[model samples]
Target: MEAWLLLLACLLIPFVVLLIAQRGAGKTKNGSRIPPGPLALPVLGSLLWLRHSSADLEPLLTRLFARHGPVVSLRAGSRLSIYVADRRVAHAALVERGAALADRPPATRALLGESDNTISRANYGPAWRLLRRNLVSETLHPSRVRLFAPARSWVRGVLADKLLRESEQAPPRGVMVVEAFRYAMFCLLVLMCFGERLDEAAVRAIGAAQRDWLMYVARKTSVFLFWPAVTKHLFRGRLKTGFALRRRQKELFLPLIEARRARKDRISRGAGAAAALKADTTFEHSYVDTLLDIKLPDEGGRALTDDEMANLCSEFLTAGTDTTTTALQWIMAELVKNPRIQENLYNEIKATTSGPEEVTEEEVNKMPYLKAVVLEGLRKHPPGHFVLAHKAAEDIEISGYLFPKGATVNFMIADMGRDEREWQKPTEFVPERFLPGGDGEGVDVTGSREIRMMPFGVGRRICAGLGIAMLHLEYFVAVLVKEFEWKEVPGDEVDLAEKTEFTIVMAKPLRARLVPRSRN
Candidate 1:
């Protein structure tokens, strides 16, 4: 009888300890109460519900949101994730109760790798606040972004030259402009990041390396995230490869960064206030410069470390390049599918241009129809299907749904972009719908109220690169339309299917015929 009692005690002890640990996990950060969420299994939590592929994720999330209401919570290990699908609930979590949801989810620390550097990955603290303020005031301020125009123009010219070469050699039907588009976008961002206009050879090498590194990171990241302990020990070689890639990127950027530092130091010694007064046009002001000059609200009175700077640089380049290029490809594919919309956009461009050389930024901005077409493109295909995961900072009741502290919150950017309730004929590619008097006029993108189509996301965590992204999209669309008349190749229709690679990118690359509008 005593032996039997000992066996039962052994089993009960483990179970009791687990129950206490879970209870501890569910409690609010302040130790008040657990946030509301679904039931969890032992170690896995709700991760069993996670789809095998990111492709399956959106539909799964949609169904879950339908069943659970807007804010549904799930626990992975000890961590809780709050999925916020309803715009109103998102508003409550991200806005009215903003402070509570201001902190970033824990996944970011590992994925972004120690972040005092990048504006996007910084936590909701004084350092982040300072970084955000500096980004707004120093670099991405509209006038400052405007200083990037010449670099943009030079890259555009390079793209035009490439397209012209493609036109001369290849049959119109055989041309796939996707690579050209990627190269052009990468060149622009690289120049912005490094402040140097790299020749085609250099640009190609850097772009190729970046692409390989990004793809590897996306493919391998889930393993690292889910089972970090086992994976790190077992997969040390692959772990090193990831770290190697990170190091490669660091090495690539270091020379440029060092050069900038040296130049700044020289200027400081020579002219002092006189040189500092003028914007240095000798070299383009790179994104690195913005990082160097801007002071963060010091953490313990010390500046951010080099590792943080490297991580931040990685984020900037990755965010700007991968997302933008994916978007450009999708936009081009859409134009190919709906030839009439492409023609309409081209006609709008033609009306504004006295001559190809005469078309300027101001002139393009005036083309309301062109702007509408770009807006429609964004609506049809948001770059990120979901905003990168956000987390709850405190226990709060949103729409009667109890959000426990430290729950991961994710919003459906693509789903919101395509919601039938907000958008009329949501599935259709009707560019006209985005016109001033059209159905999309009342659609709020800025998310001053509830989010409508959050292509750039919403609230405090919204993309600082919004203005520059828009400018690039509009500028490229205008230039492409002005230079070539896009048509679907015979026996081909644009495949608008998506694949996830840190962004919702074209499942199939866009192949289209381009007839030079200039030559015609």
Candidate 2:
């Protein structure tokens, strides 16, 4: 009887909350209607539909858009989520009137693990600006990015050597490249974050910790979204697991962070101390180093706490590694499937470079075809189908639909890129479309003006690591193609079918036969 009462209370609480919250939810003060969606049941909202559907939200959303229109709203208990599938509407909301929609939803704080503290999840205001500015200026700026060239080169070598060894081991069946791709990215990002050339065992440990935390948040934390206060007690086991994962992240990261902090302190002491630290260090600057120097004026000029630093470092590692690895896998898979395109890209790389030395950043910039291949890959298989959800700062209307101040609004990133209105053949993998005389020529990915495709997103909330992410993708893809001729394995064909995870990854992890090309 007591258990039944508890379950009844759990169900009733959210219903009552939704009843109170829905008072004026569908209309703005001016009486404009919100985007139309399915008629949500009282208390339950559209969650019944969600419960019945598979993990992937796209198929369900696609059907809803077919019935409702480009903009669709779905209520999950007390929270109202608005999804936009039209490009013009997305452009208007995210670009033309971006400030009105720049804020992150409050629930993101819990869902994304300390969203208020990190640059990606922080609410738009002074805190967000400060964090974003520090990251851009200290780490991602062009001049600063040049400092990490050696790190990228080293990671490239690590990736190439691993792939060559794996190909040698499994010559007939081809090598499963996803794990190699993920590990190589982690190595590069871990170096950039902590400013060390860690042994493979150390790198793997940190990567495992980060991945565990991310996967937990992505899969398990959503249950607590409606009312975390109540669910915390009800789902104590999950809560405990989440805390354990976070603790593991701190254990792995804090040591590296402390080492950098110690180095920073020693360098400040005198020339002798600085020389000693520099002699042992692998790189000059790191994401953690910049983070350590930050003093938040809004927070009494206090330096960030150990927790905040760990969270930021975790973000730095995950953000740089996961999306890049996913995109690289998709891009390489496409090359394997289409041998002609692969040969064309290889020819371009060959023509541009003097010989088969690793393709430098400069030579990569010169190859239009390589740039187009990367662009097409992003457009076709965006790492995340939706950009991190944005909140409507105020009641904002776009294309005649009202988005109330607190509602969560997310743009359909994959839909926008695949919109037949924008591209000639949206589904096909054609890099040439981004070249001159093609529809995508001179397309602005930043979406400052128009948004044909937004893999990195647009407006104030655009990805901070856009420049570096592009460089990594281009450089690695160039090197891989230059070193190997990626071909489809017999009976183990490249499958484009995707399964949603933290990002959309190929359902069948890309297994490709690699033929080592002789250097000229």
- Backbone collisions counted per model: 3, 0
Tell me the lDDT of candidate 1. 0.73
> Tens digits of per-residue lDDT for model 1 on 233-305?
7767776777778777777777767776766776768855345332543344777776777555464556555
The TM-scores of all predictions, comma-separated, are: 0.89, 0.93
| lDDT by residue for model 2 (348-433), tens | 99999988588899999999999999999999999999998999989887778889889999999999999998789899999999
All candidates' lDDT scores? 0.73, 0.87
The true-versus-predicted C-alpha distance at residue 76 of model 2, in Å, is 0.8
lDDT of 1 at 234: 70
In model 1, how large is the Cα lDDT of residue 393? 71
Please give the distance, in angstroms, between residue 163's alpha carbon in candidate 1 and its true position after superposition: 1.8
Best model per TM-score: 2
